[model samples]
Target: MYFTDRGIEELTARRGDESVTLEWVSDQLRTFVDLHPEFETPVERLASWLARLDDDELDDE
Candidate 1:
């Protein structure tokens, strides 16, 4: 399994039952990036991808 899957699993186990809004998630990502600048690019990409996830083109990726 991919190493990142462990973190994903942990998140699921920890907070999967909670309800969250997109704004909450966006704020969290921004806070994370503020604390961990090195991950800004990846976080930005994820945020952008999520923002445009409904677009037909990204489905192909």
Candidate 2:
């Protein structure tokens, strides 16, 4: 498994039962980037990919 999987697993284990809105997630990402500026590029890519999750073009990646 990828190293990131550990964090993903932790998140799932901690909040799997909770329901969250896209707005809430966006706000959280923004807050995270504010506190961790070095992650700006990766966070931007994640937000963009999330915004286009339903698009077929990104499937090529």
Best by lDDT: 2
Instruction: Report lDDT per candidate.
Output: 0.94, 0.97
Local accuracy of candidate 1 as per-residue lDDT tens digits, 2-43: 999999999999999999999899889989999999999999
TM-score of 1: 0.90
Task: Report the Cα lDDT for candidate 2.
Answer: 0.97
Instruction: Report the C-alpha lDDT of model 2 over 3-61, residue by residue, as the tens digit.
Output: 99999999999999999999999999999999999999999999998899999997888
Candidate 2 local lDDT, residue 26 = 95
Off by over 4 Å in 2: none
Worst 10 residues of 1 by lDDT: 44-53
Q: Please list the residue runs of candidate 1 whose C-alpha ends up more than 4 Å from where it truly belongs after superposition.
A: none
